[model samples]
Target: MTTVALLDYGSGNLRSAERAIAATGAETIVTADPGTVLAADGLVVPGVGAFAACMEGLRAVNGPRLIGSRLAGGRPVLGICVGMQVLFDRGVEFAEGIHAPEAADEAGEAAPQAVGAPGCGEWPGTVERLDAAVLPHMGWNTVEVALGSRLFAGLDPNERYYFVHSYAARRWELTDTGRIAAPLVHWAEHDGCRFVAAVENGPLWATQFHPEKSGAAGAALLRNWVATLD
Candidate 1:
């Protein structure tokens, strides 16, 4: 049986994610143990809340290192929502406050701390707040999925997925050198701003939308991911 670890780092809709993955006929365990996470056939990192807080929780259990180890060994790792954001180099939301120095020098001058939430750096880019008229682009939306994408295989190009987010990777920064396959990026528009919706880069897959809440289409995507585990 293919076992998937639903990482529990004090964030995300844990039960819902676990149920969704389990519905794909895979053995799903919602755990925070590094051993269990590392040993699983696949790892799912699901997060909901502020990026900084989620990173703190993830670091608490050394989730980033676990993910790195898995990816280094060619193991699959899936991330959703803020889970995806933390995979990048950094996130700009609440950046100023999170990285602010706790104390000032004797001259009473506060030193400028580094900006943005430090991420796992699996992908290069920063998750910044969307420049949309309406905050939190919440609803069902379709993505411009790339062709021949294993993650979007068998799914219609017009299929809509559930989304609820205020921040996203507005621009993709990875370039395709002759050395590696270029990352497949999908874009979606909300209030006239186009942002990255899904990404497929080798063993790492992520979506800004909530697949577990996306109904039938979502289930199909989850099943597709499980099918790849074989």
Candidate 2:
């Protein structure tokens, strides 16, 4: 049986994600063991809560090193929700009255300044607050799937996924490095603001939404990813 390490770095929707992936018939292990994480057939990094806090926890168990080593060997790895966000270069958390530059009003006035936390830098972009009037773009939303997306294979284009996040990577800045193939990026919009919903780049695949909580469609997505482990 295929084995997947569900990284338990003190964050993420652990039990739910574990049950979801295990439902795909893959043996899932929720662990903080670096050796197990790197040795598994696949690794699932599921995370929730603030960006900085998640990073702190991830670093605790050498999460970044393990992820980097896996990708270096072309081993498959998956990231969910905040797990996906930390894959980027940085994440800026805005204060109560502040907003991201992308969230600037029509008048072009600047929002209050905010500090950023360093991310895993797997991709070149910053996770920032969405411009939507609503604080969290909670609930269900459909994504604009990228052509040839294995993650969305066998799923309807209009299928909605469960999203419960206010911050997202609003841009895809990783350009072709010539040696590396370009990443396929899926997008979603909320109140006129667009953000990256998912990305499939070689050995690394990620979703900004919680697939474990997304019902049948989510199962299909996880199955699709699990299929790629071979």
The digit string of per-residue lDDT tens for model 2 on 153-197 reads 999999999999999999999887343667899999988999999
The weakest ten consecutive residues by lDDT in model 1 span 95-104
lDDT of 1 by residue, 1-230 (tens): 99999999999699999999999999999999989999999999999988889999999999999999999988999999999999999987743433223333444757545446799988888998787757678999999998779898999899999999888999999885232667789999999999999998988999999999999999999999999888
Per-candidate local distance difference test: 0.89, 0.91
TM-score of each: 0.89, 0.92
RMSD of every prediction: 5.7, 3.0
Best by lDDT: 2
Regions of model 2 farther than 4 Å from truth: 96-113, 177-180
